[model samples]
Target: MPQATVMERTPFIKPNPASTQAAAVSDGSRIGFENVSVTYGALTVLHSFTLTVNPGEIVALIGPSGSGKTTALRAVAGFVRPSSGRILIGDRDVTNLAPYDRKIGMVVQNYALFPHMRVDENVAFGLRAHGASEDLIRSRVPECLSMVGMSAYAKRYPRELSGGQQQRVAIARALAPRPQVLLLDEPLSALDAQIRRSMLDELAKLHRDLPNLTVLYVTHDQSEALTLANHIGIMRDGRLQAFGDSKALFRHPPNRFAAEFLGRANLLPVSGLKPADEGMAQVRFGGIALSARNHHGLADGSDCLICIRPHDFRFSRSAAEPNSVSGTVLSVQWQGDVHNITLNIGGEALRMSCPPMTNPPGLGETVSVHFNPAEVTLVPEDGARG
Candidate 1:
């Protein structure tokens, strides 16, 4: 596990597991955005953002900075008013609601805990803000703290806690108010690698404990999204570029951006697109035939890019495979358990990975690499899918 990335360590986070679903409290607290668009003066920040987070589902919105992922989350929290359209929690419209009235809990990157407040007080703040009975706050504060495994730290102040502990307390505070929806905006971004890894598990457990708590998570970390979310929404330039079940979206990205942004990928230009048997399509890359899924049902003879993840490419000892291709080795990097390979395929750069190569091919040496047709998927060159 020394060199393992989050993706390598965790399976795609499943939708609410059976045990959690059975314990879930039914509330129709689904999160919805209907053509929600936000503008500041002349600049449009979010463009007609529309997506649904089902009750008990964790949906992550991910993208580069200024892509409106946070804007979309804030809109749901009632912090940023939409210039057009509406936002809803369950079936109740909350576009015009006050932040305190939205029944949405938000955890930010900074933790945002009151420095002078003890952990218990911080957890109690939300309930008080919502005008809960003192008895409710007393019981809820301890219950939420226990749920996050922070009941022992209830007497400690934020300054006395580590970053990871502070984040736990933050999450506890968010859950204290019995919110129908929780918005986590880069909640683990501030932690180091080790702590972030553990926090990811903590979050997954938290969702299981409170399965009815709908979540809209905004993050730039693809692995975190893939590890914690049942559904993922990839944003780009203030638009929802792609949204689907997490595993499906990663395996069949709708465009070049989604393909590259979701993971490390080699996009090779291909032409001569044609249908093959069993729902497959063929494209030619530098005179070499490549077959893959036609996710978009692209028209015949159209040009598009074939996306191959680094790990999907395997070194070929023989050219017996139908999907075999030759590449000139550019460089090979030994990164613990895996070999990172840079290759020249028809003059374009492609990257691949393999088990540690004890005697890696020398730079400029010709090498053969092959991939499964099922492992490769197509992305439209111009970012559109027909």
Candidate 2:
């Protein structure tokens, strides 16, 4: 068995005396799941998941449905005990602790606000339940609401507020007790696109204000994960498929699932993988030879997939350009800022994005697309998931 590597807990920083909001922020907690697994009867929902969330860092767990993101969050909250392994919070083993003892706050998708309660009472619920003094609850309730910019609406009922406002109240309620960690489960999923964007900005501002607040955000929205999280954990089929810094993970995915899941990827089937100069390889696809950066030790003539992002391809008129391929435009869809162009190369369909300011090729027009060798990624053919 591999030895468990424990991370050193970060020391708590004192709040700045000049900022009143800093007094309401709790010392961030380091969370770790060591070889954890969750099961219900004969079904295993999470398989040997291991991850460590650094103190004061935001980590987002993202995947499709049944990927065990919520299950992992529940384990951290002590709502679901791991069938094996251990969970830790700031050096304390909390795997067997009750939910209320974990010292973590959670805001769910539906906002979960009490319909009959005013915003102030809703925010005070946690503190009151924790047996806080009446004076402390009164002070903490307004402080929390103020932190979320909801102090003006403290007397309004949940039904009287908009979706975004209610969500702000819910977040205030979660943070009222000053828990060490905050778990958000699709908190912005119910809002419209515009509201969601605005709320994302609000959440970012909140993080800035509460610099010591550790967050574990769960969502299937890749854009949200990319926008908010410092680290991203990609889950699939009860396992953590990929985990690392968000930008690095998206740029250099380890497998096909991650490459496709993080963002758009054009998986071009290629063969004849041979080493070229400058850490590059020569690959042949559809009778056209292309150069790609080769990190994987692919044997000569081995079948593989060349992964490229749609934005990496540039429209060209010359077939003589390096890594150039000619294809006929099949369809064009204009997005608000860019145009999505579909092309038929040989018999395979490929998607590319072009700037709206530049007119894309018309349907049935033959055009050449050029890609740089540095932008190509080589992966084994079998790395693709079903």
Candidate 3:
């Protein structure tokens, strides 16, 4: 038995019952993990985790490498068994079920296609293994290939196709079985940026066409999760930090890890010992006063931290508005469509990304930054406030 790695302890938030139930009932597929924990030898890869995926729903598992996103998918796919608890597919307990008996289709990053088999034959392999009639395999293989726009290249072997085409074949092979759940493990990571973009479009179309298929997509790409998944599960270490619709989690992350991981955020530490009316408090940062929403109901003489997104920070040469911070421009990088500016403030580097570089400020110049209080999140410095 080996020791559990440091990345296996990240926390995750389960979706509320209303959201989970609504998503499950609306979609045709249902997946649920109840108090699930998995250990390999002596290393516990997943904690007591629970999550639900509705039918026809695409849930993107986003996290750092070794955070157990793939482990969770494998648990659901029956590749890895939970040491305790149950996995339910469409309300049936499938935790102890065999991988082949689980009836799930998997497409991984490597696009593992049979080297000797032609594209059509690769797509038909699963159906044939499942003992589908020859007529059904013939009818379904072409249709699956056509769905991924690989019908014309059905006769091409895996080695003859480009990386993207081979991935399409892999997807075709996975979809040919039409399993209750589709598990995609970083399926676009093998392709170049351009091909990845094109495949995303094709995947989006596939989602629209087959609205009844439950998709459990695993990726480390944040932008891909944002673009493809209606619901997102943010994992850290091995725990799920947050799970909700893309919009809700992005708009309001429950913790500092989630706020920073889901996207770019500017964290500002603040402290004060006084409280205002109705459990609300005014904390000062960099000699400027700011009001906190105080969802944690802070008492008098309690310290709190503040978080503001980089985009939320607006810049102006003249300091005329409230909630302004003064900083010296460190360096600037032109990213074609936007300018990423690093500013030096209070011994910490603050980054600001502004739209399409036009008349940007010069480096070494001092600038005033403004941010809305509403856009700011109030978190306690010691993991107390959200």
Task: Say which candidate scores most in TM-score.
Answer: 1
TM-score of each: 0.91, 0.89, 0.86
Residues 84-195 of candidate 1: C-alpha lDDT, one tens digit per residue: 8889887789887767656667899999888989999998876666556777778888899998989999999999999999999999988776667889999999999999
Model 2, range 1-386, lDDT digits (tens) per residue? 33222223211122222323322333339899999988877788889999999988899999999999999998887767788889988888998876766778888899988899999988877776666777877898888888888889988999999999999998998887787899999999999999999999999989998878899999989999999999999999889998999988877677788888888888888998889888789999978999898766777789888888889889876777789998899999998899888889878788898789466678999988999888777877775463
In model 3, what lDDT does residue 80 have? Answer: 75
* Model 2 score (lDDT): 0.83
Candidate 1 segments exceeding 4 Å error: 1-25, 384-386
TM-score order of candidates, top first: 1, 2, 3
Residue 68 displacement in candidate 1 (angstroms): 0.6
lDDT of 3 by residue, 235-348 (tens): 876789889999777766667777778888777777773565654567877677776556556555566566677787788556666577788999989889888888887766
Choose 1 or 2, whichever is better by TM-score.
1
- Total clashing pairs in model 3: 6
RMSD for each of the candidates: 8.9, 6.0, 7.2
